[model samples]
Target chain A: MQKLTKEQQDYQNFVKQKRPKPPLLKNILMAFIVGGLICVVGQVIMNFYISRGMSPKEAGAPTSATMVFLGAFLTGLGVYDKIGKRAGAGSIVPITGFANSIVSPAMEFKREGYVFGVAAKMFVVAGPVIVYGMCSAVVIGLIYYILKL
Target chain B: MAGKKMGLQTIRFQNPPSIIATSSIVGPKEGQGPLKDYFDLILNDNMYKEKSWEKAERKILKEAVEMAIKNSNLPYSKIEYFIAGDLLNQIISAGFAARELGFPFFGIYGACSTAAEGLGLGAIIIDGGFADNLVVATSSHYCTAERQYRFPLELGNQSPPTAQWTVTGAGAAVISSRPQNPRITYVTTGKVIDMGETNPNDMGTAMAPAAVDTIVRHFNDTNRTPDDYDLIVTGDLASIGKDIAEELIKQKGFDVSNKYTDCGLMIFDPQQDVHAGGSGCACAAVVTFGYLYKEMMKGKYNRILLVATGALLSTTSTQQGETIPCIAHAVAIENL
Candidate 1:
């Protein structure tokens, strides 16, 4: 934090005191319930795929694809955001939220047209995650190779 | 001849310019707000049949100006100048609106303080004999402002409770040399005050100090007190900033608690799920031109101090770790 003037510091303290805080317990409970429900849905989908004679390991990719499709479809339908508003981190921490993070911006910026709008802006929210995720995977792969050596 | 300049920051108009007519147009959300009846037009959709939110905002501003002129019984040619601003970058909403207006335009940017700034300058022009008739207008759109300032419209992130919703509306007023009931008496321009606040989300806290500073200066320069005006309204302090401004003003030896409120608070009902309240250039604009103007005409408030506050922080500045600089301009409107 930057250093503040005496008056600014005092006023900041006063403002902090006066500001209303969100209900922490209520939010936590909501996140738990909503997040648990999302996981249950994923589990059910996985079980359905497994029941169709696919091995559990083989069913994983399709289950994930199905979850992403659901997330993107719900976002297109303008319902995922409403769910996210109430669910908070519950909605955000899941893989579906990742799909939402991409599709939402794509839809929002579509007004600028196809090339510059939807294509360019689709990864804006998810760009950092993709970059860092790729970088870390490379680093871990190098470490694994070195350990084998 | 006595100078028009008051104590320090205020100007006392020798011949107060009158707000002869006003027009307010709002989106569906603000239409559902408590002051719905006061607005001249309420669109069923925020898009208003436009291709983009920016275009829609420009149209809203343009219509509001035309409607105000029509209400004033003044021909379009009679309007000497067009002074307007909006929350958009380059003030494009007002700039594009002024393009179609064909009047000598003064496209200004004072963030949310555009309404008061336009009115103050418009009044000065009329009172200074620069022009007889001018239209002062301001507008803001929620979708445009959201994408520009915070996040994309469809971003599923939760806003803090202190975060305010930007009002989607436009307000315009016809200021004339003709005598009328509600006159612009005094104007107090504020200095940029930074209280070391950096958070862009909590604008209320950042701007409260500036609002209080302007309010105190207005009273001091005009030799007036809280009793002098029936109401003292801030632009968009919402709940947190309004409370802070009231407390700070009291500390500065002015008791405006009973008479003070905010346009941010006035625009949206408490149960509207807008977190703190409504904000943006349109917040004060619509409330003043629509709700308060109608109330003033009905003799509910004989005089009022409209202190419009603005946080002068850009996304680049915020990203650069700079504190939010804030300003406020106070305009005294009295029925004489």
Candidate 2:
């Protein structure tokens, strides 16, 4: 790339002085705390399901589903948005985050109609994750079957 | 009578309309800012007990218009016209308020620059004998705008450092033939200018060039330097836009760094994690009507130039892979 003009260089310097620097340390701390708390909630839910006469693996599935439902509900109630704003990426670190991904687009495009808007746009964000997950799972399962043979 | 055309893209009002009164209303976040005391009302909640954020925006706009009329000492029936706009697709916030007030209305859409555009047009109508008394109002809400332009509130996505929080507020100003201290002296309407910026997350950068264009045109047309005004304020440029604008002006052989400030940066405290600062139609509207208007009344600032900038891109347009087109409009308000 060519060197910037003197005027452009000056502009860069001026902008640097005026622009704010984010508090990296504080943001990292907040993300750690918030993300950690969300994980703890998931664990507690899993434990509850286990104590209610379910295996740990079975508990895990229900707990994840519950978290997704909670996330979507909180998003509809406008609570999660505020938390996302304050907590940054920390809020997007769990099954709840995936729920947000689905619900947000559905809500945004609801004006566009159900079939085209809600149903179609619902997976616009999450489709890639689903596709990759299935593809990888199939490949892993085939490998496991071959090893057993 | 045709107003005097001063230089290119500017109008020098022959009989400048007197700015009789101004009113501003902001959300709780802005209420906690430095200029909090100057606004007339600060909402405790975004919804104001309303069913939706859109309705809340309309409520604030109506309140601001009512407050401006009351402060102008004009009876509700006496106001001749209402000119207003907002960031909504149909600008329903302004439209709904106009419906509620039942005034002769002119709806405008300048995106974030609506406040200055409304003021400039209101002044023209008053000066041109189209109306005797008029009010210019504009508003925006964070919740209403976010869902429309970006993702829904529940997305839980991380906003980058360049993102700006939309200020939830409304501001209104009354202009009339009645002699008042601060009067509209000049208007510089801007042309649509875009530099092919497509990033929706960083709107300040997209709109900053337009701000520069208008500011430079104002100075060039009026044959006045930045030093002529006590304070040179731009609406909703936020921190990033303001810095770029200051540098751009410097390239044009003027330095306004000492006196210039942006309404976006002024209305929110940096510690609040508002990213770049505030944006939206109300960002400039509230800061101008709330803080600057009150300060001018105290004889603190004499001559002021308000240049409001806007990125005139719709969510539909952005989705279609169109670059953001932006504009800015400037009006000179002076204590005469």
Candidate 3:
């Protein structure tokens, strides 16, 4: 956030004009298609659970768990990241991405041994999400209680 | 009073040291690149049977050094010094490799420019009669660099268009006083230049100015133009930085576009999908030692200016909102 001198600023502008911009349209399209497919798959799983005599609300938790398991499985098989690379927001905005966020560091750091490696690094990427998620949930819950809604 | 100095920031070596031998080892991805055939060893996997990527990188460096020494037809005891570096924190790759190699080690860190830096220093050591034979080596791993500088390998984030793929490889060259064809003649060291660029994902932009600065300085110091050399190659400026440096150098009254190219652009083909191209300590190292050196041996290029560029920014430095300071080291390797 420091102010750049005129020479630096001019050079930066020159570089900016040269740098390639990402394909926004293609990225958006890929994210939409891949994200939609993942949602459809989740829907099918939920419907299957409903047909098995479980209530829609009761199936929600299992559906998410199944999705998480699937995510972890695909990550272990090393397919999710390849999809994520091109899918961009599609692979990342889902519950499966949450699984991927945790499992990836776990696998990458496995060489450091189980304790400092797997266990320690498992939450590195996901830790922020979990901490912020819980904090926001608590704040929203307090607001909800106060508003009685 | 002049001594060995050639203009400011440039050194004219007396009795230039020759590159007796070189070796390159690349991972599966880089092995699939355009310069695949130039490499000495291509691993099927990045891990190379090692338990960790860091250890794999160390092994690659060690193998490259040993292979280069072997190729030089010199016994292990002949190499008096080992100058090595890497992109890893503490340069552990070179440090660990040196520990096993057991030569008088000089562990250096010049980010991606480590190869050229090592080569310049190694040449100086040999030319100065400090050592009869010495090795200059550098290595960089995509996995290690990613985890160290950016994100985890599994993070599903998209790399920007200007972002570069870290070349997973190691390159080593044996420099000695023995008369040889291609020799290191002059070294134009670079001053750290920061153009107030802060985007870590776009290192090409950050390092381009430094590359241009060193290139211009090299031209001024040596009183040579682009026509003097068959090629003027930058380390890892890739697509974006290459263009930027090309234009900036032209603006500085030197038109090297005809002979100019980059290691980053040479390593990967257009179909490789490596955004801006390749970047890493290994980028210049592998390309120069593998492709260029072999081509030089074939007498394809008489003189070449190898300007290796590096962005000296750590994860901590970027996080602290500091501008990336970049540098380039130019070494003139020619058929003498």
Task: Identify the leading candidate in terms of DockQ.
Answer: 3
State each candidate's clash count.
0, 0, 0
Candidate 3's DockQ is: 0.76
Taking every candidate in turn, the Cα RMSD to the unseen true structure, in Å, is 1.3, 4.2, 1.2
Task: Tell me the TM-score of each prediction against the true structure.
Answer: 0.98, 0.86, 0.98
**lDDT for each residue of candidate 2 in B44-109, tens digit (9 for 90 to 100):** 998898867888999999999999999988998889899999999898999999999999999999
- Residue-wise C-alpha lDDT for candidate 1, range B46-154, written one tens digit per residue: 8999998889999999999999999999998899999999998899999999999899999999999999999999999999999999999999999899988987766
lDDT of 3 by residue, B155-254 (tens): 7778899899999999999999998879999999999999999999888889999999998998898798889999999999999889988999999999
B119 in model 2: Cα distance from truth in Å?
A: 0.6
Candidate 1: residue B336 Cα off by (Å): 0.9
What would the per-residue lDDT of candidate 2 be over residues A1-149, giving only the tens digit for each residue? Answer: 23455654554455556555677887788878888888998999899999999999888889989999989998898788777766776887677888888888888777678999799989977888889989999999999999999
Question: After TM-score superposition, what is the CA distance of residue B330 in candidate 2 from its true location, in Å?
Answer: 0.7
In the predicted model 2, the residue pairs found to clash are none
Give me the chain B TM-score of candidate 1.
0.99
- At residue B317, candidate 3 shows an lDDT of 89
Model 3 steric clash pairs: none
- Tell me the spans in candidate 3 whose CA falls farther than 4 Å from its real position: none
